[model samples]
Target: MQEIKATMAGSVWKILFKEGEQVGANEDVVILESMKMEIPIATEKAGTVKEIKVAEGDFVNEGDVIVVVA
Candidate 1:
């Protein structure tokens, strides 16, 4: 399993994949909004999305797990 973590403190703005969906390496899985900028978070490897640890409008800190792929 691989954990896709947030790169910076922000509010979750969007989720690009659903649980159990297949994802490619470096695919953007989530988008976060911080300081009025959108930041996309991507998975480092190809895998099935096992979990989404956050929801739109949720606040997260840097390094917080946002998605899990396996």
Candidate 2:
């Protein structure tokens, strides 16, 4: 299993992948907004999306889990 974590503190702007969806390595799955900038979060491992831990507009701190892949 692999955990996709936020690289910076920000509000979740969008979720691009759904649970049970297959994702490739380095695919962007979530977009976050902070300091008027958009940050895209990508998975480091190829796998199915098992869970999404954050929702759109949700605030997350750096290192917070955003999604899980397994």
- Which digits, one per residue and each the tens of the lDDT, describe model 2 over residues 1-70? 9989999999999999999999999999999999999999999989999999988999999999999999
lDDT tens digits, residues 1-70, model 1?
Answer: 9999999999999999999999999999999999999999998999999999999999999999999999
* Alpha carbon lDDT at 56, candidate 2: 95
Q: Each prediction's Cα lDDT score?
A: 0.96, 0.97
Off by over 4 Å in 1: none
Instruction: Quote the RMSD, in angstroms, for model 1.
Output: 0.4
Q: Estimate each model's TM-score.
A: 0.98, 0.98
